[model samples]
Target: MNLTQLNMLSDAQLAARVAQDIPDGSYVNLGIGKPTHVSAYVPEGREVIYHSENGILGVGPTPPPGQEDLELIDASKRYITLAPGAAFFEHTDSFAMMRGGHIDIAVLGAYQVAENGDLANWATLDETYPPAVGGAMDLVVGVPTIFVMMKHVNRDGTPKLLERCTYPLTGLGVVSRVYTDLAVLDVVPQGFRLVELTPGNGFEAVQAATGAKILT
Candidate 1:
């Protein structure tokens, strides 16, 4: 089936969906790219402390236009605001927070994710651009829960949720859940377990889009 025919969630909508699942009173890190959008949609009444690997805690939503602080940015180098009681520290301290298990969750983007929860977001086969793993390795090992936010397929219409990742693994069996444009899935011992389908998307359609079998 053609992807355009499916009523897939927009990036903002997908972010909001992921935001709704995050528990209150958690310290979370949003990976660069699509995952960064999740920060702006945290549900009201919940207190989620956002952490930037580049060294900022209590990260807030994106600042309104004309209110941008050129000096303030997240790991993605995108302009951001600070929530109340925000703090800044050196990179050493920032990494320590990530590596010391102080972070509760890490929402990251991915190139591919295997059925067994293997993540391959850091590097791909394309040699044009240098591979940058960033803090993903640290977060996957230290943070208790890992939520991946990414498109369900590549530009060529190949699935990103696969039986086995074709790219280099960032961390073995690290992903807890995956939120894609079509559906939400949990990494279970059996494989990709369908948690929920995006509105207007059917089970079979989503399964066809996925490279691996999605357990009901």
Candidate 2:
């Protein structure tokens, strides 16, 4: 199969796909970057509780333009509003929730995820870019399920889903599934398990794009 860009999901579309997987009444932590957008697209019938590292829990979607409160922000520092019945707490208590296994799922962006579920999202090999890992180390360990939302390829068109990660790891064998622009894949023992593909793409094209073996 040759490369084709047809039907590739935009970032918002990918965010919606991640949102649809979350179950009702689950306490979730959406990490900085693309994962933060998941807050806005949670399924209509489900009630998902959002947790943030900077002392916020039960957070809500980001406000529309001009409705933003610069003072109120999540871990990503994105201006947001609180959901009904949302609570505010101390930073230590917030981390306690993440570290104490209270978070059900954590959706995070990744630089790389290995076949065995090893995750490397914190820093690249370049020392020039200082990394801020924040609560990622804790979330991946405590949360029962980890879902990564990221691009299928780097800017230079290399696979981010790989046989092994070259970057510093945030957690080991922690990723359960990954949602990317090209496809949705689960990190199984053998390798990536195909879930669904973008329209107009075939298994061969996806296999070519990935760095690891693909298992149906």
**TM-score of every model?**
0.94, 0.93
Candidate 1 per-residue C-alpha lDDT over 27-57 given as tens digits, one digit per residue, 9 for 90 to 100: 9998988888786788779999999998999
With a 3 Å backbone cut-off (N, CA, C), the pairs that clash in candidate 2 are: none
- lDDT of every model, 2 decimals: 0.91, 0.88
Clashes in model 1: which pairs? Answer: none
Which lDDT value does model 2 have at 129? Answer: 82
- Give me the runs in candidate 2 sitting further than 4 Å from their true place: 1-7, 64-69
Model 1 / residue 102 / CA error / Å: 0.8
* Per-residue lDDT of model 2, residues 7-28, tens digit only: 4679999999999999999999
* Strongest candidate by lDDT: 1
Span of 10 residues, lowest total lDDT, candidate 2: 1-10
